[model samples]
Target chain A: MGVIGVVATMKVQAGKEAEFEKVFKDLQSKVKANEPGCLQYDLCKSKSNPQTFVIMEQYESQEALDAHGKSDYFKAAFPALGAVLDGAPGLEFLDRID
Target chain B: MGVIGVVATMKVQAGKEAEFEKVFKDLQSKVKANEPGCLQYDLCKSKSNPQTFVIMEQYESQEALDAHGKSDYFKAAFPALGAVLDGAPGLEFLDRID
Candidate 1:
């Protein structure tokens, strides 16, 4: 009913941070341009670990987040993202309290 | 120089979600009212597990974030919060890229 927030942690392979960032920038742009329900989409680099990225996203609702996952852009981008990640990303989904 | 984002995972002991949330709301108010550099302070509940709360915060800069940690409010609030949490909260600090 309220905002759906997502926190996803990605660990890039040692030498692949730069490459991963390049690919991610495009994905972020597409998320912003294509997904109207997506309220905020931000990618951030960890202060302590340069190879780790934490994506912070907010959607209008749970259904909106579900739709974002089903988008063609996401279908393509997810695989591209997986290839650079060290392991499966840690994802936590939440509903905003305030 | 840029936005400082924080993702903190808190697993509250069962039956404490309500209390934790109550205390947290007060803390959130304190952060917003007292800290000019704190751009955002949001607390969220996990959809699958209500016991887990994720705090998403943004600050104007690294220095602003540092000041937040040293504030009297934080020093007092952190201990009050820790009493309800299951274990040490997982914290990740990031610099927004987009």
Candidate 2:
């Protein structure tokens, strides 16, 4: 009942991948450091498409996701990076199925 | 360069969730048992929709994924289960980004 995962796909602007990576790396570190409920946070690029990125994040619960969304780093970092996105990011919350 | 992840989403038919679950659990076990290159294999459901299922599978490389696809169980299981699906599954291979 405690496990929650987030699946999000983002289309980073072609030339802005480097900047996106920089921000994403910091966000990853910050999420890991400040958020204890965050169990895993992984950043991935599409194999067939270099400009697309996917984030696989696992949290302890829905509360944890809420906490992460409300965190200073997420609030600031995500929006700052949003402008450079090539398209709208697809975000979904997931429940572990047994 | 070895880390590879597969993200696929399936829409299971209503009332056949139990059948899907049974087959899926067996597939999970089989994949884990036969594939050493498979690092992580997890099944997830959408938080808001119980009919939607998402598979988060990680392999050591594209070669590993190809091996998995060609493996006896995946070849048989996926297609057999596909017949019960409500819609076409979305499958994508992902590359690790640093």
Candidate 3:
């Protein structure tokens, strides 16, 4: 049973785009090293809104995602990331409906 | 069976962001009218590069996607879109691996 997934959209503070991207980019190596279930992790920025970004993650299952949430990198960097974010992130967990 | 889908990235010319978006916004009404197969159609731009955009489309299957490709709006607008694009867009079609 494969679960279809989606990109999670997060918004950064007005002047914190560079800081946010740097933090996210740094987490890349850590996330890749530890999260075995993460098939793909990509970061995308909004062309229209410089403060908005989309993070796309592909995982095997909810279990893997839960693990990812609990990882050290997630714990260590989330606070810094959260402080610079303007609002809550948007999550779209999708399933095929056809 | 349902098909897993991904977003397609498209880049606009250096100074044609507004024109591209205007054209895209116009296609919005047309796309919605004809492509019922399009479960979702979203447009996003890169925060780092306003000229870069990503169009995410979700469809039931390849047949439905084929229909979208042949739509009247696609035919009319793609040519205009092509002329302003700097390079080919990026595409990521995904499926669960676990």
Candidate 4:
């Protein structure tokens, strides 16, 4: 009902860290510039594992979150991002308690 | 070396959500008010599983994060919070890629 937070845990292919990050950063910038409802969109690398990365995102509402997935840039970037991924990313939706 | 984020994934005991939230909220407030380097401290509940909760936190540096764990308030609240946990929490440290 309120802000929605999405934690996307992903494992990059052993040697594709650079490719994965480049594609993701492009997507990140597009999301931030075009989606006003998207509050926080940042990429993070796990301190312990070079291959593990997480995308921490916050959206203003359900519609905004939905818009993100359906955006043209997101759709265009999906394949590139997936290509470098070790496997499917783990997605967990969280409802902000504030 | 830069801003750090910690994702704490915890499972609260069934029916202990209220107690867990209460203790966590108290700790959250203290962390927000007293810790100057704590940029974000939020508690979130998973949409799919009520028992699953995550604390999304950001610190200016690793030192700030270390201080959070050693704070007297954090020390006092740990036991109360642990009592309501389903199991040990999973902690992931992240280096912000920005």
Q: Compute DockQ for each candidate against the true complex.
A: 0.83, 0.74, 0.05, 0.93
Off by over 4 Å in 1: none
**lDDT, candidate 3, at A15:** 92
Model 4: residues >4 Å from true position, as ranges? none
| lDDT values, one for every candidate | 0.91, 0.86, 0.70, 0.94
lDDT per residue (tens digit) for residues A26-88 in model 4? 999899899999999989999999999988889999999999999999999999999999999
C-alpha lDDT (0 to 100) for residue A2 of candidate 2: 58
Worst lDDT run of 10 residues, candidate 1 chain A, spans: A71-80
Please tell me the TM-score of chain B in candidate 2 relative to the true structure's chain B: 0.93
Off by over 4 Å in 3: A96-98, B1-98
Tens digit of lDDT per residue, candidate 3, span A1-98? 35434567788998998898889888877888888888667676654566777776666777887888888888899899999999888765543111
Candidate 3 Cα lDDT to native: 0.70
lDDT of 1 at A25: 95
Per-residue accuracy of model 1 over B1-98 as CA lDDT, tens digit each: 68999999999999988989989999899989999999889999998898999999999988889899998888888888999999999998899995
Model 3 root mean square deviation, Cα atoms: 13.1
Q: How accurate is candidate 4 locally (lDDT)?
A: 0.94
What ordering of candidates by DockQ runs from best to worst? 4, 1, 2, 3
Ranking according to TM-score, highest score first = 4, 1, 2, 3
In candidate 1, what are the lDDT values of residues A1-98, reduced to their tens digit?
78999998899999999889999999889888988999888999999999999999899987889989998988898888889999999888899997
Please give each candidate's TM-score.
0.94, 0.93, 0.51, 0.99
Q: What's the alpha carbon RMSD for model 2?
A: 1.5
